[model samples]
Target: MTFPLRWLWWLPVLLLLQACSSIPTLPVAPTTTPVAGVQGMASYYGARHHGRKTASGERFNQNALTAAHRTLPFGTRVRVTNLNNQKSVVVRINDRGPYAKGRIIDLSAEAARELNMIRAGVAKVRVERLE
Candidate 1:
């Protein structure tokens, strides 16, 4: 013979648990060796996003060899290699991003053009941090 009021107490707790589970987690950057760098789809910034202040507090330069990585520390340099064309460019990690699903890095427009990826907008690549 439980009171009806007792069951209502669990409703708020259940809702809170559901809400916690729905929140997304921040992406963690890879800490592997240079030879075993992270691998994923790489995207590039467009003209629309140029000149904005990046997470590192520096203005984004579309023509610079810079990149936005979810977890790499600002000022860290990385070598991004395009597996399709075997082209590679070294870029400094000055921002955080590639927030889109499954992408690991976002390159500046100049970096993408060096890799011949401007036409594709995205590429399959490997990222190795420079020591």
Candidate 2:
């Protein structure tokens, strides 16, 4: 059965309304700057992930002082200090993860070793963005 042509006009209006409904009302994230002395938990990437391409498009090196942050831009250098032993390491942001609750950064395996946290697997850390 065929409907009357009058319904054609209503069809376009309905589609327009549907499209407008699909638009997000707010942004998923907000504009922000990296805060100095952000404190949180830090972990490390293991040997299994070495040589993999990171989110920043660099090959992951277990021995290099590199790190992953949730929001820091790639190539941004930061000093990660372990609160337990007061050890610190400078690492460049080369990825984005930890994928763990309450974790702020993910360090390279070597960085973890330098921090004396490889055995513990995680540490309370203070992250200071470098200029």
Candidate 3:
């Protein structure tokens, strides 16, 4: 009986040791720097998604100067340039992503219009992180 009780106590100690060993000593933080010359398809969302709660919990405003970026942290400012018309607009990221596979950014309706991309629905643009 005493032998069994001793083994039970050691069992818990062994399990505790195993758990501690499994934990990583250090965790890595994700780097948020934007790659230079990153180009991709950009699109806009408007009345359909306006007034809805965004992932950041802010009310989505179609007229606001905001954008969605895949990897840029929220509050990052970027300059988006329309390659076709050479028009550019500065937008702040307030949301998580464009959600489309190949898209790197999603602009508000007004931003799209500013870039002269309202008709195309999608445009090839260059996104540069504003310092």
Model 1, 47-86: lDDT tens digits are 8888889999999989899999887789999999999998
Q: Model 2 over residues 1-131: C-alpha lDDT tens digits?
A: 98899878998899989888865586555444467899999999979999999998889999999998888889999999999999999999999887999999999999999999999999999999999
Residue 53 accuracy (lDDT) in model 3: 86
lDDT of 1 at 116: 95
Evaluated against the true structure, the overall lDDT of model 2 is 0.91
Backbone clashes in each candidate structure, one number apiece? 0, 0, 0
- What is the Å distance of residue 93 in model 3 from its true position? 0.3
Better of 1 and 3 by TM-score: 3
Using all chains and alpha carbons, the TM-scores for the candidates as numbered come to: 0.73, 0.75, 0.75
lDDT of 3 at 21: 87
